[model samples]
Target: MHQQSAGQLPAEVLAAFQDEQQQLDAAGIPAGVATVGSVMPDGDLLDAHGEPTTLTAARNGRPAVVVFYRGAWCPYCNIALRAYQEQLQPALATRGVALVAISPQTPDGSLTMQQTKELTFTVLSDAGNQIARRLGILTAPTEPVRQAQAALGLDLTTVNADHTPALPMPAVALVDTAGVLRWIDVHPNYATRTEPAAVLAALTTLD
Candidate 1:
Protein backbone atom coordinates (compact mmCIF):
# COMPACT_ATOMS: atom_id res chain seq x y z
CA MET A 1 0.00 0.00 0.00
CA HIS A 2 1.15 3.51 -0.71
CA GLN A 3 2.23 5.53 2.32
CA GLN A 4 -0.65 7.98 2.16
CA SER A 5 0.03 11.43 3.52
CA ALA A 6 -2.06 14.43 4.54
CA GLY A 7 -0.86 16.57 1.64
CA GLN A 8 -3.39 14.86 -0.64
CA LEU A 9 -5.98 16.93 1.24
CA PRO A 10 -6.08 20.03 3.40
CA ALA A 11 -5.75 19.74 7.18
CA GLU A 12 -9.50 19.81 7.69
CA VAL A 13 -10.21 16.94 5.26
CA LEU A 14 -7.31 14.96 6.69
CA ALA A 15 -8.89 15.19 10.13
CA ALA A 16 -12.16 13.92 8.70
CA PHE A 17 -11.04 10.70 6.95
CA GLN A 18 -7.74 9.50 8.40
CA ASP A 19 -8.80 5.86 8.33
CA GLU A 20 -10.89 4.47 5.44
CA GLN A 21 -13.84 3.29 7.52
CA GLN A 22 -14.12 6.52 9.52
CA GLN A 23 -14.96 8.16 6.22
CA LEU A 24 -17.69 5.58 5.64
CA ASP A 25 -19.36 6.53 8.93
CA ALA A 26 -19.42 10.23 8.23
CA ALA A 27 -22.78 11.26 6.84
CA GLY A 28 -23.26 13.96 4.22
CA ILE A 29 -19.51 13.97 3.77
CA PRO A 30 -17.90 11.37 1.46
CA ALA A 31 -14.19 10.54 1.78
CA GLY A 32 -11.74 10.11 -1.10
CA VAL A 33 -7.99 9.90 -1.73
CA ALA A 34 -6.45 12.11 0.94
CA THR A 35 -3.24 11.04 -0.80
CA VAL A 36 -2.80 11.39 -4.57
CA GLY A 37 -1.55 8.86 -7.10
CA SER A 38 -2.09 7.70 -10.68
CA VAL A 39 -5.69 6.62 -11.27
CA MET A 40 -6.43 2.97 -12.04
CA PRO A 41 -8.68 1.33 -14.64
CA ASP A 42 -10.14 4.76 -15.34
CA GLY A 43 -12.88 4.55 -17.94
CA ASP A 44 -16.15 6.09 -19.14
CA LEU A 45 -19.42 6.59 -17.36
CA LEU A 46 -22.94 7.07 -18.62
CA ASP A 47 -23.88 10.68 -19.06
CA ALA A 48 -27.08 12.10 -17.58
CA HIS A 49 -28.93 10.56 -20.55
CA GLY A 50 -27.25 7.20 -20.11
CA GLU A 51 -24.65 7.50 -22.85
CA PRO A 52 -21.19 6.26 -22.04
CA THR A 53 -18.52 8.95 -21.80
CA THR A 54 -15.10 7.71 -20.86
CA LEU A 55 -12.52 9.45 -18.71
CA THR A 56 -10.03 9.02 -21.51
CA ALA A 57 -12.47 10.80 -23.80
CA ALA A 58 -13.02 13.63 -21.35
CA ARG A 59 -9.50 14.38 -20.18
CA ASN A 60 -7.47 13.94 -23.35
CA GLY A 61 -4.38 15.95 -24.17
CA ARG A 62 -5.69 19.06 -22.52
CA PRO A 63 -5.79 20.45 -19.04
CA ALA A 64 -9.09 19.48 -17.42
CA VAL A 65 -11.06 19.91 -14.23
CA VAL A 66 -13.43 17.28 -12.89
CA VAL A 67 -15.94 18.10 -10.18
CA PHE A 68 -17.92 15.43 -8.40
CA TYR A 69 -21.16 16.25 -6.67
CA ARG A 70 -23.95 14.48 -4.89
CA GLY A 71 -27.25 14.62 -6.73
CA ALA A 72 -28.85 17.98 -7.53
CA TRP A 73 -31.05 17.62 -4.43
CA CYS A 74 -28.31 18.80 -2.14
CA PRO A 75 -28.38 22.58 -1.69
CA TYR A 76 -24.65 22.74 -1.20
CA CYS A 77 -24.13 20.65 -4.31
CA ASN A 78 -26.29 23.11 -6.19
CA ILE A 79 -24.18 25.98 -4.93
CA ALA A 80 -20.96 24.30 -5.98
CA LEU A 81 -22.35 23.40 -9.41
CA ARG A 82 -23.74 26.86 -10.05
CA ALA A 83 -20.57 28.47 -8.86
CA TYR A 84 -18.65 26.45 -11.41
CA GLN A 85 -21.22 27.04 -14.13
CA GLU A 86 -21.38 30.79 -13.63
CA GLN A 87 -17.94 31.68 -12.34
CA LEU A 88 -15.44 28.81 -12.45
CA GLN A 89 -16.02 27.82 -16.08
CA PRO A 90 -15.18 31.20 -17.59
CA ALA A 91 -12.23 31.70 -15.31
CA LEU A 92 -10.73 28.34 -16.17
CA ALA A 93 -11.47 28.60 -19.90
CA THR A 94 -9.41 31.77 -19.93
CA ARG A 95 -6.45 29.64 -19.01
CA GLY A 96 -7.24 26.97 -21.64
CA VAL A 97 -8.65 24.64 -19.05
CA ALA A 98 -11.75 22.51 -19.53
CA LEU A 99 -14.31 21.87 -16.81
CA VAL A 100 -16.61 18.89 -16.43
CA ALA A 101 -19.19 18.25 -13.69
CA ILE A 102 -19.88 14.61 -12.92
CA SER A 103 -22.71 13.03 -10.96
CA PRO A 104 -24.79 9.90 -10.86
CA GLN A 105 -27.91 11.85 -11.85
CA THR A 106 -30.03 10.48 -14.70
CA PRO A 107 -29.78 12.01 -18.16
CA ASP A 108 -33.19 13.61 -17.94
CA GLY A 109 -32.22 15.00 -14.57
CA SER A 110 -28.92 16.18 -15.95
CA LEU A 111 -30.69 17.84 -18.87
CA THR A 112 -33.04 19.62 -16.51
CA MET A 113 -30.04 20.65 -14.45
CA GLN A 114 -28.19 21.92 -17.51
CA GLN A 115 -31.19 24.03 -18.40
CA THR A 116 -31.70 25.13 -14.84
CA LYS A 117 -28.05 25.92 -14.17
CA GLU A 118 -27.16 26.96 -17.72
CA LEU A 119 -24.03 24.86 -17.53
CA THR A 120 -21.93 24.94 -20.72
CA PHE A 121 -19.52 22.11 -20.09
CA THR A 122 -19.81 18.36 -20.16
CA VAL A 123 -21.95 16.72 -17.48
CA LEU A 124 -21.37 13.00 -17.23
CA SER A 125 -23.38 10.54 -15.18
CA ASP A 126 -21.70 7.86 -13.17
CA ALA A 127 -24.84 5.85 -12.85
CA GLY A 128 -24.48 2.86 -10.51
CA ASN A 129 -21.75 4.81 -8.79
CA GLN A 130 -19.49 2.86 -11.14
CA ILE A 131 -16.99 5.68 -11.47
CA ALA A 132 -16.95 6.35 -7.76
CA ARG A 133 -16.58 2.71 -6.88
CA ARG A 134 -13.76 2.32 -9.36
CA LEU A 135 -12.08 5.39 -7.90
CA GLY A 136 -12.52 3.84 -4.44
CA ILE A 137 -14.68 6.67 -3.15
CA LEU A 138 -18.18 5.26 -3.20
CA THR A 139 -19.80 5.01 0.24
CA ALA A 140 -22.93 3.36 1.51
CA PRO A 141 -25.44 5.81 2.89
CA THR A 142 -26.27 5.82 6.58
CA GLU A 143 -29.60 4.23 7.45
CA PRO A 144 -31.30 7.56 8.08
CA VAL A 145 -30.49 8.82 4.60
CA ARG A 146 -31.52 5.52 3.07
CA GLN A 147 -34.89 5.76 4.75
CA ALA A 148 -35.31 9.40 3.83
CA GLN A 149 -34.36 8.75 0.24
CA ALA A 150 -36.83 5.89 0.01
CA ALA A 151 -39.54 8.09 1.51
CA LEU A 152 -38.69 10.92 -0.87
CA GLY A 153 -38.22 8.63 -3.91
CA LEU A 154 -34.71 9.90 -4.28
CA ASP A 155 -33.26 6.47 -4.91
CA LEU A 156 -29.70 7.08 -6.03
CA THR A 157 -29.76 3.96 -8.15
CA THR A 158 -32.63 5.41 -10.14
CA VAL A 159 -30.99 8.79 -10.14
CA ASN A 160 -27.83 7.09 -11.31
CA ALA A 161 -29.80 4.96 -13.73
CA ASP A 162 -27.98 1.84 -12.52
CA HIS A 163 -27.60 -0.68 -9.71
CA THR A 164 -25.13 1.31 -7.65
CA PRO A 165 -26.94 2.38 -4.50
CA ALA A 166 -24.15 4.25 -2.77
CA LEU A 167 -23.00 7.81 -2.13
CA PRO A 168 -19.88 9.36 -3.70
CA MET A 169 -17.15 11.69 -2.60
CA PRO A 170 -17.84 15.41 -2.75
CA ALA A 171 -14.70 16.70 -4.36
CA VAL A 172 -12.90 18.11 -7.39
CA ALA A 173 -9.75 16.84 -9.08
CA LEU A 174 -7.44 18.77 -11.38
CA VAL A 175 -5.49 16.97 -14.07
CA ASP A 176 -3.02 18.40 -16.49
CA THR A 177 -2.83 17.62 -20.23
CA ALA A 178 -0.92 14.46 -19.50
CA GLY A 179 -3.57 13.12 -17.15
CA VAL A 180 -1.49 13.75 -14.07
CA LEU A 181 -3.20 14.87 -10.89
CA ARG A 182 -1.98 18.23 -9.74
CA TRP A 183 -4.51 18.93 -7.01
CA ILE A 184 -7.58 17.49 -5.36
CA ASP A 185 -10.07 19.18 -3.02
CA VAL A 186 -12.36 17.07 -0.89
CA HIS A 187 -14.81 17.85 1.90
CA PRO A 188 -16.04 15.51 4.61
CA ASN A 189 -19.16 17.58 5.21
CA TYR A 190 -21.75 17.40 2.45
CA ALA A 191 -22.95 20.85 3.48
CA THR A 192 -19.62 22.30 2.34
CA ARG A 193 -17.22 22.04 -0.66
CA THR A 194 -14.21 23.63 -2.29
CA GLU A 195 -14.84 27.18 -3.51
CA PRO A 196 -14.49 28.38 -7.13
CA ALA A 197 -11.67 30.80 -6.48
CA ALA A 198 -9.65 27.99 -4.99
CA VAL A 199 -10.39 25.82 -7.99
CA LEU A 200 -9.07 28.52 -10.28
CA ALA A 201 -5.92 28.76 -8.19
CA ALA A 202 -5.41 25.05 -8.70
CA LEU A 203 -5.64 25.54 -12.46
CA THR A 204 -2.73 27.96 -12.20
CA THR A 205 -0.54 25.03 -11.27
CA LEU A 206 -1.13 23.68 -14.78
CA ASP A 207 0.67 26.74 -16.14
Candidate 2:
Protein backbone atom coordinates (compact mmCIF):
# COMPACT_ATOMS: atom_id res chain seq x y z
CA MET A 1 0.00 0.00 0.00
CA HIS A 2 2.78 2.42 0.88
CA GLN A 3 4.58 1.45 -2.31
CA GLN A 4 1.44 2.33 -4.23
CA SER A 5 1.26 5.70 -2.49
CA ALA A 6 4.92 6.41 -3.19
CA GLY A 7 4.40 5.53 -6.83
CA GLN A 8 1.33 7.71 -7.25
CA LEU A 9 2.36 10.73 -5.20
CA PRO A 10 3.72 13.74 -7.03
CA ALA A 11 7.41 14.49 -6.73
CA GLU A 12 6.86 17.70 -4.77
CA VAL A 13 4.71 16.03 -2.14
CA LEU A 14 7.09 13.11 -1.77
CA ALA A 15 10.01 15.50 -1.42
CA ALA A 16 8.18 17.35 1.31
CA PHE A 17 7.74 14.11 3.28
CA GLN A 18 11.39 13.27 2.82
CA ASP A 19 12.39 16.68 4.13
CA GLU A 20 10.23 16.16 7.17
CA GLN A 21 11.84 12.78 7.82
CA GLN A 22 15.25 14.39 7.68
CA GLN A 23 14.16 17.01 10.17
CA LEU A 24 12.81 14.32 12.50
CA ASP A 25 16.10 12.46 12.30
CA ALA A 26 17.89 15.63 13.35
CA ALA A 27 15.52 16.22 16.28
CA GLY A 28 16.14 12.78 17.77
CA ILE A 29 13.93 11.01 20.30
CA PRO A 30 12.90 12.90 23.39
CA ALA A 31 15.11 12.69 26.45
CA GLY A 32 14.11 10.84 29.63
CA VAL A 33 11.39 8.98 27.80
CA ALA A 34 9.73 5.87 29.18
CA THR A 35 11.40 2.64 28.15
CA VAL A 36 10.96 -1.05 28.85
CA GLY A 37 10.26 -1.84 32.52
CA SER A 38 8.62 1.55 33.03
CA VAL A 39 5.00 1.85 34.01
CA MET A 40 2.65 3.07 31.27
CA PRO A 41 1.49 6.61 31.66
CA ASP A 42 -2.10 7.25 32.68
CA GLY A 43 -4.42 9.74 31.02
CA ASP A 44 -8.13 10.49 30.78
CA LEU A 45 -9.21 9.51 27.28
CA LEU A 46 -12.55 8.95 25.58
CA ASP A 47 -13.68 5.71 23.99
CA ALA A 48 -15.52 5.42 20.71
CA HIS A 49 -18.70 5.66 22.78
CA GLY A 50 -17.56 9.07 24.08
CA GLU A 51 -17.28 7.67 27.59
CA PRO A 52 -14.30 8.54 29.76
CA THR A 53 -11.73 5.74 30.05
CA THR A 54 -8.11 4.84 30.47
CA LEU A 55 -5.75 2.36 28.85
CA THR A 56 -6.07 0.09 31.85
CA ALA A 57 -9.82 0.00 31.49
CA ALA A 58 -9.42 -1.05 27.91
CA ARG A 59 -7.09 -3.81 29.02
CA ASN A 60 -9.73 -5.09 31.46
CA GLY A 61 -7.20 -6.93 33.71
CA ARG A 62 -5.38 -8.42 30.74
CA PRO A 63 -2.09 -7.53 29.10
CA ALA A 64 -2.48 -5.02 26.29
CA VAL A 65 -1.09 -4.11 22.92
CA VAL A 66 -1.60 -0.39 22.38
CA VAL A 67 -1.29 1.20 18.97
CA PHE A 68 -0.82 4.92 18.48
CA TYR A 69 -1.95 6.20 15.11
CA ARG A 70 -2.22 9.62 13.47
CA GLY A 71 -5.96 9.87 12.78
CA ALA A 72 -8.87 8.67 10.71
CA TRP A 73 -7.94 11.15 7.98
CA CYS A 74 -4.71 9.27 7.34
CA PRO A 75 -4.87 6.50 4.77
CA TYR A 76 -1.80 4.84 6.24
CA CYS A 77 -3.46 4.69 9.63
CA ASN A 78 -6.55 3.07 8.13
CA ILE A 79 -4.52 0.46 6.35
CA ALA A 80 -2.51 -0.30 9.46
CA LEU A 81 -5.58 -0.59 11.65
CA ARG A 82 -7.34 -2.93 9.25
CA ALA A 83 -4.29 -5.08 8.88
CA TYR A 84 -3.94 -5.38 12.63
CA GLN A 85 -7.55 -6.38 12.97
CA GLU A 86 -7.37 -9.04 10.30
CA GLN A 87 -3.94 -10.41 11.13
CA LEU A 88 -3.02 -9.54 14.70
CA GLN A 89 -6.13 -9.34 16.83
CA PRO A 90 -6.82 -13.04 16.86
CA ALA A 91 -3.32 -13.87 17.92
CA LEU A 92 -3.52 -11.26 20.64
CA ALA A 93 -6.85 -12.65 21.79
CA THR A 94 -5.34 -16.13 22.15
CA ARG A 95 -2.75 -14.58 24.40
CA GLY A 96 -5.47 -12.94 26.47
CA VAL A 97 -4.23 -9.52 25.44
CA ALA A 98 -6.42 -6.68 24.27
CA LEU A 99 -5.64 -4.61 21.21
CA VAL A 100 -6.33 -0.91 21.61
CA ALA A 101 -5.82 1.79 19.03
CA ILE A 102 -5.33 5.42 20.07
CA SER A 103 -5.39 8.64 18.06
CA PRO A 104 -5.74 12.37 18.60
CA GLN A 105 -9.08 12.42 16.82
CA THR A 106 -12.22 13.14 18.85
CA PRO A 107 -14.40 10.36 20.20
CA ASP A 108 -16.85 10.95 17.36
CA GLY A 109 -14.13 10.56 14.81
CA SER A 110 -12.90 7.47 16.59
CA LEU A 111 -16.36 5.98 16.45
CA THR A 112 -16.61 6.74 12.77
CA MET A 113 -13.30 5.09 12.09
CA GLN A 114 -14.06 2.05 14.23
CA GLN A 115 -17.35 1.45 12.45
CA THR A 116 -16.02 2.25 9.00
CA LYS A 117 -13.11 -0.10 9.51
CA GLU A 118 -15.29 -2.74 11.16
CA LEU A 119 -12.81 -3.00 13.98
CA THR A 120 -13.69 -5.24 16.92
CA PHE A 121 -11.08 -3.91 19.32
CA THR A 122 -11.10 -0.81 21.44
CA VAL A 123 -10.54 2.54 19.76
CA LEU A 124 -9.90 5.57 21.94
CA SER A 125 -9.37 9.29 21.49
CA ASP A 126 -6.38 10.76 23.22
CA ALA A 127 -7.46 14.33 23.62
CA GLY A 128 -4.56 16.79 23.71
CA ASN A 129 -2.21 13.79 23.41
CA GLN A 130 -1.87 13.58 27.16
CA ILE A 131 -0.69 9.96 27.13
CA ALA A 132 1.48 10.26 24.03
CA ARG A 133 3.24 13.30 25.43
CA ARG A 134 3.96 11.44 28.63
CA LEU A 135 5.34 8.56 26.56
CA GLY A 136 7.47 11.05 24.58
CA ILE A 137 6.18 9.99 21.18
CA LEU A 138 4.18 13.02 20.11
CA THR A 139 5.45 14.89 17.06
CA ALA A 140 4.23 17.99 15.27
CA PRO A 141 4.36 17.97 11.51
CA THR A 142 7.11 20.00 9.92
CA GLU A 143 6.09 23.16 8.09
CA PRO A 144 6.71 21.57 4.70
CA VAL A 145 4.78 18.43 5.63
CA ARG A 146 1.92 20.51 7.04
CA GLN A 147 1.81 22.57 3.86
CA ALA A 148 1.80 19.44 1.75
CA GLN A 149 -1.02 17.93 3.79
CA ALA A 150 -2.99 21.18 3.52
CA ALA A 151 -2.49 21.12 -0.20
CA LEU A 152 -3.80 17.57 -0.20
CA GLY A 153 -6.98 18.84 1.59
CA LEU A 154 -6.09 17.35 4.97
CA ASP A 155 -6.26 19.95 7.69
CA LEU A 156 -4.71 18.47 10.82
CA THR A 157 -6.22 21.10 13.08
CA THR A 158 -9.71 20.08 12.00
CA VAL A 159 -9.09 16.35 12.42
CA ASN A 160 -7.19 16.41 15.68
CA ALA A 161 -9.16 16.67 18.91
CA ASP A 162 -6.70 19.09 20.50
CA HIS A 163 -6.51 21.27 17.37
CA THR A 164 -2.73 21.31 17.83
CA PRO A 165 -1.88 19.69 14.50
CA ALA A 166 0.40 17.21 16.29
CA LEU A 167 0.46 13.42 16.02
CA PRO A 168 2.07 10.53 17.80
CA MET A 169 4.64 8.56 15.84
CA PRO A 170 2.94 5.31 14.82
CA ALA A 171 3.84 3.02 17.71
CA VAL A 172 3.00 -0.38 19.20
CA ALA A 173 3.68 -1.00 22.83
CA LEU A 174 3.07 -4.17 24.84
CA VAL A 175 2.10 -3.58 28.45
CA ASP A 176 1.92 -6.32 31.06
CA THR A 177 -0.99 -6.74 33.45
CA ALA A 178 0.93 -4.64 35.94
CA GLY A 179 1.04 -1.74 33.42
CA VAL A 180 4.76 -2.05 32.79
CA LEU A 181 5.89 -1.75 29.20
CA ARG A 182 7.44 -5.01 28.07
CA TRP A 183 8.04 -4.16 24.43
CA ILE A 184 7.63 -1.17 22.14
CA ASP A 185 7.96 -0.19 18.50
CA VAL A 186 8.04 3.48 17.56
CA HIS A 187 8.24 4.28 13.86
CA PRO A 188 9.52 7.70 12.88
CA ASN A 189 8.13 7.37 9.38
CA TYR A 190 4.42 8.03 9.27
CA ALA A 191 4.17 6.01 6.08
CA THR A 192 5.19 2.83 7.93
CA ARG A 193 3.81 0.83 10.85
CA THR A 194 4.68 -1.92 13.28
CA GLU A 195 4.09 -5.21 11.53
CA PRO A 196 1.62 -7.68 13.01
CA ALA A 197 4.10 -10.55 12.80
CA ALA A 198 6.58 -8.57 14.86
CA VAL A 199 3.89 -7.80 17.42
CA LEU A 200 2.97 -11.46 17.65
CA ALA A 201 6.60 -12.35 18.21
CA ALA A 202 6.77 -9.82 21.02
CA LEU A 203 3.68 -11.32 22.58
CA THR A 204 5.25 -14.79 22.57
CA THR A 205 8.11 -13.55 24.71
CA LEU A 206 5.70 -12.23 27.31
CA ASP A 207 4.27 -15.74 27.73
Per-candidate count of clashing residue pairs (backbone under 3 Å)? 4, 0
Candidate 1 — what's its lDDT?
A: 0.66
Which residue window of length 10 is worst by lDDT in model 1? Answer: 1-10
User: TM-score of predicted model 1?
Assistant: 0.76
Most lDDT-accurate candidate:
2
- Least accurate stretch of 10 residues (summed lDDT) in model 2? 108-117
lDDT scores in order = 0.66, 0.86
Clashing pairs in 2: none
- The prediction achieving the highest TM-score against the true structure is 2
RMSD of each: 9.2, 2.0
* Candidate 1 stretches greater than 4 Å from native: 1-34, 111-117
Q: What lDDT score goes with residue 119 in model 2?
A: 91
